[model samples]
Target: MRFLIDFFPIALFVLAYKMADIYTATAVLMAATIVQTGLIYARDRKLQTLHKVTLLLVLVFGALTLFLQDERFIKWKPTVLYASMAIALAAALWIWKKNFLQILLGSQLNLPAPVWARLTIAWIAYFLFMAGINAYVAAYYSTEDWVNFKLWGYVFPVVFIVGQGLYIARFIKDDDDAVEKKP
Candidate 1:
């Protein structure tokens, strides 16, 4: 369900592209994102920092794509999003002595701090790599190829993330003693 919510805008973008054009796809994506943002705000009764940032950039980039009629603007959106997240995680690791990813997901994870920190850094690096891949694909690929990448690349990472989550689950129980003894 959450995955569907996340993919909704991209699906709309593909549909709009097929039905009308890039501009139409951009517009449809913006509408879908706006609705998604609204739902997030309504459910939380306030905007999260990450959600606000993502919404702001998506709106800005979506409008730029519409205004300039340059498909590149829309294409760059994912790269920007991924890069920004990677940078944020890296900053948290270096500056705060806290693992932002663990903090964000800690309620459900019982991993030790050091393990969580390492996982956070790994995720940051992974995001950065994905951003680079997105840039390369968007810059060089044909429109159909880029769209296909968007549609298919998503599934691969999702599967990997889930697999990693399951792997981490095993470590969670193993770390329970360390977690409970923490000061």
Candidate 2:
């Protein structure tokens, strides 16, 4: 349910691209994203930082793509988003001496400081890699190829998320285990 809410916009964009053209797809994506954000706000009564960033980028890039009659703006949107995330994560960890990921998820999963630091670094690297790959694909490929990559490239994030979950599983303490260990 939540997954569908999150991905329906992208799915609509892909379908629109296949059925019509890039401009049409961009319009569909813009509208779908606006709807998605509205739905999230309605349901949660608040928006997360990530959601706000995504909505802002989509609006800005989508407007540029439509106004300039150039597909490049839409193509570069993912790279910009990924780069921004990488920078934010890196800055939070290095300059601020904080792990934003830990701050967000710490309540759910109790891990040591070292583990959190490593996880944050891993995310930074992943975002950098994703940004680079998206830029390369958008620059070197045709619009059709880039569209195909955009739809299929979801695998990278899915794999990364699964791997991250598995890596952190060892550090996660069940309530029963924590209780059992209490003196």
Candidate 3:
């Protein structure tokens, strides 16, 4: 359910590209992203920073793609987004001595300060890697190849998320620990 809502735009974009062309796909992506963001806001009553960023980039890049009749803008959107995320996370962690990820998710998950710092660093690295990969593919590959990579490149995030969960699992206190501590 949640996954479908999150994936709605990308899925639609790929489908549109297959059925038509990059311009049509860009339009579909723009419309689908708007719809996806609306649904998220309706459910959560507010948008996450990520959701807002994604929406802005999609609209801006999609508009440029359509207006210029050039696909490079849409193709480079992911690289820009990922690189920006890496910079933001790194700045928050080192320059400001603040961990945005911990600030964002600390309430839901309790972990040591060190764990939070490490997680933040890991996220920064992941974002950089994603940015680099997207840039490489977009610059070096044909549009069709780049589009195929976009569809298949989803594996990276899925694996990274699962790996992150595994890394944090040991630090998270289970309900059983609380029950035992009560005695």
Candidate 4:
């Protein structure tokens, strides 16, 4: 449900682009995203940083895409968004000496502070790489090709993150076992 809600606007944007009639798709994108935001707020009573950022970007970049009739702006949206996240994560580590990623997600999984720091840095790097890759594809690919990549690229990072989580979980399990056996 969460995944579907998150992706609903992007899907509408692509469909609207393909249809390419009266900017109907941008309308759909805006409507869906607004509703998504409302629903999230209703559920949580508070907005997350990511949600606010995504909404702002959608409005700014989506409007540019519609008004300018340039899909490049829309394509670059993901890149900018990812780049911002990467910068934020990096700043949290180097400047603040706090791991926002772990702060956000750590309660679900018990891990050492060092491990969280490492994971946070890895995620920051991943975001930077994703932004670069999005730029590369957006620059070189055809419209349809770029849209397909935007739709499909979502899965690649999820797969990588899950793989990393599984790898870490294995070590965590071993650590737990060792502690349990230590009397």
Candidate 5:
């Protein structure tokens, strides 16, 4: 359910692109993202930083893409977003001596400070990789190829998430183990 909310906009954008063109797809993405944001707020009553950032970027870049009739703006949005995320995470960790991943998910999982630090660094690296890859594809590839990459690039996140889950699993205490220890 949550994944659907997060993904439907991109899916619709691709569908719109297939049926019409990049301009139409941009409009559909803008509208779909707006709807996704509203649905999230309605469900949670508050928006996360990522949600707000995504919404703002979609609206701003989508407007530019449509208004200027340039597909490059839309193509570059993901690169900008990923770069910004990497920068923010790096600055927060190094300059501020804060771990945002810990702040965000610390309550849900119990892990050592070192583990959280490692996870934060991992996320920063992942963002940088994503940003670089997107920039490369957007710059060197045709619009058709970039669009195809957008659809197929879902593999990267899925793999990253699974890898992260595997890493975090070692730290998560099984409920049954806790219960057995309680005796």
Candidate 6:
């Protein structure tokens, strides 16, 4: 349910691209993203920083794609987004001496500071890799190929997320274990 909602825009864009054209797909993506964000805000009563950044980039890049009649702008959006995330994570970890991943998930999982730092660095590296891959695909491939990559390339994130979950499972304290350890 939540997964479908989160991917509504991308799915719509893919469908539109297959049925119509890149311009049409861009328009669909723009509208779908706007609606998706609106629905999220309506349900949550607030928007996260990630949601805000995604929405802003979609609007800006979508507009540029439409105005310029070039698909490159929309194609570059993912690379820009990924690069920004990588930079933000790196800055948070080094300059601010903060692990943003820990800040976001610390309440749910209690991990040591070193573990959190490693997780943060892992995410930074992942983001950088994803950004490079996206840029390479967009620059070297055709529009159709890029669209196909966008749809199929989701496998990378799915694998990364699953691997992260498995890696962190060892650190997560089960309820029974936590209770037994409590004095």
Query: Each candidate: what lDDT?
Result: 0.83, 0.94, 0.95, 0.82, 0.95, 0.93
Tens digits of per-residue lDDT, candidate 5, 1-183, equal 998998899899999999999999999999999999999999999999999999999999999999999999999999999999999999999999999999999989899999999999999999999999999999999988898899999899989999999999998999899999985
* Tens digits of per-residue lDDT for model 1, 1-183: 667777888888888887888889888988898998888777768876777777888889999998988889889988998899998888889987778877887897777887787788778878888899999999999887887788788875787698677768767665677789899
- After TM-score superposition, the amount by which residue 81's alpha carbon in candidate 1 deviates from its true location, in angstroms, is 1.0
| Tens-digit per-residue lDDT, 24-136, candidate 2 | 99999999999999999999899989999999999999999999999999999999999999999999999999899999989988999999999999999999999999999
Candidate 3 residue-wise lDDT, 10-102, digit = tens: 888999999999999999999999999999999999999999999999999999999999999999999999999999999989999999999
Model 2, runs deviating above 4 Å: none
Among these predictions, the greatest TM-score belongs to: 3
Name the lDDT value of residue 146 in candidate 3. Answer: 89
Q: Tally clashes: model 4.
A: 0
Deviating ranges (above 4 Å) for candidate 1: 174-183
RMSD of model 5 against the true structure: 1.0
Model 4 CA deviation exceeding 4 Å by range: 21-23, 171-183
Clashes of each: 0, 0, 0, 0, 0, 0
lDDT of 6 by residue, 68-180 (tens): 99999999999999999999999999998888998988988999898899888889899999999999999999999999999999899889989899988898879998799
Model 4, 69-182: lDDT tens digits are 876777788899999999999998999988998888877777888888888888898999999999999899886788778678889778877977886784465667778999
- The deviation in Å at residue 129 for candidate 2 is 0.9
Per-residue lDDT, model 6, residue 146, is 97
lDDT of 4 at 94: 92
lDDT of 6 at 36: 95
Q: Give the TM-score of candidate 6.
A: 0.96
For model 3, which pairs clash?
none
| Model 3 lDDT-worst window of ten | 1-10
Candidate 1: C-alpha lDDT: 0.83
Q: What is the lDDT of residue 178 in candidate 2?
A: 82
The local distance difference test score of model 5 is 0.95
Q: What TM-score goes with each of the models?
A: 0.87, 0.96, 0.98, 0.85, 0.97, 0.96
Displacement of residue 64 (Cα, Å) in model 4 is: 1.8
